[model samples]
Target: MLKSWTAMFAAGSVISLLVVVSSTSALRGQPQPGLAVASAGSIHLALGNPSGATEDPANKDNFLVSKPQYALSYNDANGIANWVSWRLNKNDLGIQGRCKDSRGRDFFAADDSLPTGFKQIKPDEYDFPVNGFDRGHMAPSADRTANRPDNCATFLMTNMVPQRPNLNRQVWESLESDSRQLVTRNGRELYIIAGPGTKRGTIADNRVMVPASTWKVVVVLDAPELGLAGVNRNTRVIAVNMPNTKTISGNWRSYLVNVDQIEALTGLDLL
Candidate 1:
């Protein structure tokens, strides 16, 4: 089955491969088919899904959504993505810039792709004047600058979580820049997974959960063609669990952690 799936993936039948995997899982009575197999190409999630997310209505918290730019497991109850996964190569970088308004603020659009009845968070919800948080991107806007729609998709509210202004602007932003440098400078391809961890509080009148920490796992491969098959003992995996608080400061490397620790904290298997 693995060999067949690899052949199908190599043939570029990503959607067809997903259908087969889903059908086979149903017949075997396993947990609903995960999106990992569904996203096994140069598209988003070249490695695999960390959480077993599916489109099943019953699994609203871990509902899977695949976009041209990236893939994510959106948690309806929490009103944020459980995790976002994307493949980043040098070709994905461009000068398209971030989707912003005339005021130079990011255009946080509501995601209409979510099914009816799921709470669609609006942009104004993050407009707290006193103790407001920045709309942090799980998959940073800079990572998807290949085109207009690709960059615009990063601004969707589903891809956001309430992050401290300092954390988002400083340390987190630095790491995002460094990730891009890996592609531009070293010519490495990265498979990244990021999400919030441990609800710290509530925002947007309790509509959105503020996570205590933001975690990410970056799998860096020497070349884009290698994909998942390239991962080995020597593969460089950078995982960090940064606190989502104003007091946090300094380099993102200070908050470095092992992948297993991040998995234990967020309850997701990140490879």
Candidate 2:
């Protein structure tokens, strides 16, 4: 049977100030290596030029270049590989690091939120509410236990937000499932990084190259043989966002956002 692939995850990112959202990078971490990592700031979270992020071509939209961040073992519960101190770099953050086992099973605890070196951010202090925000994922659920509990720390209130239930469960989730399956089925692996982006100006749902809350799940497949497209030796990018379910109607349609032709608008040399 020519089976199809599937990937699943919610669409949204919200939580308290103490939260550690994983909406930007791939799911590659080294918490087992005992390295201290912290949540990204607004500039760090910017997708276009704020943070100077790269891109992923496999998934729906070209997103970012996520990387693995690790640390030595911390506590015995996390079963960390080491506890020695280390440092995580830029390649270790944002929509480039949202993949499966290719990354670590656990995410980092806050530098201030009680020594998060391979330490799981237990939800004891913070409450994870269903109506509050979307279950912002760190290490991709596929990388953890089926229920995303192997590294329960990654599922903290700091890494979540309010997301649309339908889109989260429908198109977006399908993308996640398909990505992971592409790895197992093809004997390869896929890396992904997802999250939110805000445009420079605000106009009440102003449309930009990247939309807010679109739950931009930037996926990066390692092997080129997974029948993948939208990428190249350098980088191919996709920038899809969550649908505005609040106003989405069947009678709606989207087309090119310009009056001039492609050459006129971009002013590029096509001839």
CA lDDT, every model vs. true structure: 0.76, 0.28
Worst 10 residues of 2 by lDDT: 251-260
lDDT of 1 by residue, 207-255 (tens): 8999999988776777567565554434566778899988989988788
Q: Runs in model 2 with CA error above 4 Å?
A: 1-133, 136-139, 146-150, 199-212, 217-219, 222-239, 244-271
C-alpha TM-score for every candidate: 0.84, 0.37
Residue-wise C-alpha lDDT for candidate 2, range 116-233, written one tens digit per residue:
2323333332222523223334233344332333334344322332234444445555654554554446543333333333322222122111123433323343444432332233
Question: Against the true structure, candidate 2 has what lDDT?
Answer: 0.28
Candidate 1 regions off by >4 Å?
A: 1-42, 102-104
